[model samples]
Target: MIEHKDYCVPADTWAARVAGGDRRALARVISFLENDDPCGVAALKELYARTGRAHIVGITGPPGAGKSSLADKLIRELRGRGKTVGVVAVDPTSPFSGGAILGDRVRMQGWTGDSGVYIRSMGTRGSLGGLARAAYGTIQLLDAAGFDYVLVETVGVGQSEVDIVRVADTVVVVAVPGLGDDIQVSKAGITEIGDVFAVNKADLPGAERVATELEMMLDLGNHAAWRPPVVLTVAASGKGIPELVQAVGDHFAALVRADQLVKRRLAREKEALLLRLAERVRREILQSWSQEELARLWSDLAARRLDPYTLEERLYSVWKGAKEA
Candidate 1:
């Protein structure tokens, strides 16, 4: 029961309820984060100090690679070990509605009654990096809510999907067999971010070959400190899930032992800070501005009457005016 004024939870009360593991409170805070509520920001500022406890595992790979199924199995496996889990499932947004059509909740409905697991689905919402604008904040809220693990599942994979590596403690890239040239998971840029590579759908043909190829790629790469392991997983049947979980733990342990965990955490903080600052600056720059003005600017640029750089300078001048006003 969050004490609220106009649907906004009080900061102290919000923190108290979340700390107590109240599900409703947690959901309300999550909504606040999703909606970009000021109250949510305040609660986050208070709860921020309590974060960084949960291990964030990011599951990302190409479409149809069973990333969601793997995430579901991983949750079960984690719960078997007496761990509570939180999942941030990123789904592609509907272009017209700007809402997630098949968010993780629809697929993971079985866990709806489970007390040890919490699942949240976010629409990509036009965000380019396969994450919602509020994702970083959501993870911290989950951490402050006392989840043992926070798993982030990206919408899909590509070189740009590497943003997951910036936030997750361990990144597991899931791949399937039979895609020789169309292997999106193993692209040179995408391969470098994976802490562990999984050849999923092992029941299918060519799984072994995919695993072998991943291992060979790892061998060729200059991963001086640690070589990412390629594991076989049939996510649908739960095959190799235990081993995959172990691999995730092993990678985390390696990071810890090498004193690299703090370095990654530092990088995550830097990224979050920059992201927030940039968004804030942009929002303030456009506050109360009309769409017509922007459209006119675009039209002028399209007509080549105004160069982009000159328009940007003019926009900055408008921002300065707004700031002073």
Candidate 2:
């Protein structure tokens, strides 16, 4: 974990700044979240009540599908509608630095001056998945900071990208012409997950054919009530953005009408709980064990005097909330 030891302020102070729309303060909290700081956790508890207002939209697809360009365009259009927007981009890891090489910020630098728009790029940090490990917590922080629309951009690869469904309220899967099935995007899983589809780079030669393919794929889907809409977009020039936003709005409206929004949120939070537990336990559980107990376990395992099962039982006992060895 990279510590931003600069943050010595109280969690409540950061919480106030976040609720008041201080971008720097919000960014600090997100950094703390990635580092798994107790201060960050405390701040989230302080501001958790202000959450559940932002509409989380996930943008994902195969690489070179212009997903980042589309996300940049959406931020512009969403802001034009008087909506405050937050963008969480899960970028590929940098080999040397092991940090996020930001693609979205570079494309959307025009909005950097606008305080209403907050964009964060997160690296996968060696975690093998389409998103940064801390992406879910980052979204909650943004929501509590009062963003009206939060757009999460996935690391465009393949089925690993389907992790977006764990956090997003409405998901947009972007695709381009000439992308074959080589990416191993589990066809059934992809179809069921996308709430909106965009055939980006529509000016390309095979755009129409690709859109048609998507339509046929949509027909095979088992989505009830709300069908995913395929919209063509030249994301670079901002074409078809309004219609795409409306498509997202339509899916969200359907979820609300069916009273499924709360249900989905509950499910997401439940999953988040498991992920958080896994992260925390992996990081701290072993370190918290008594050194004397660990030394005894190692000695017993090496001497061939005690069986491995007995040693395992001792650790299992500690894990089940026993303080004694």
TM-score of each: 0.88, 0.83
Cα-based lDDT for every prediction: 0.79, 0.77
Question: Taking the tens digit of each residue's C-alpha lDDT, what string does model 1 give over 1-325?
Answer: 2234564545778887887889898888777766656667777778888998999999988766888899999999999999999998765543222234655233565887898999887764455442454677788889999999999887556434336777799999988897784455457566788899889999999999888777777787898777898899998899999999999999999999999998999888887788767867887777646899888889999999999999888888989887688
Candidate 2, residues 1-325: lDDT per residue as tens digits? 4333446455678889888888888888787766657667767778989999999999888766788889889988988999999988776543211133464333656787898898877865545432444677778889998999999887553434337888899989887876664232345466678889898989888888777877887788777778899999999898999999999999999999989999999998887777656766644556667789678778878998788997666556666664344
Error of 1 at 2 (Å): 19
**Global CA lDDT computed for model 2:** 0.77
lDDT of 2 at 3: 32
* RMSD values, in order shown: 3.6, 4.6
Top-lDDT structure, candidate number: 1
Model 2 TM:
0.83
Candidate 2 deviant stretches above 4 angstroms: 1-9, 95-100, 103-106, 126-133, 157-162, 181-188, 282-315, 321-325
Best by the TM-score measure: 1
Point out where model 1 deviates above 4 Å.
1-9, 94-106, 124-131, 159-162
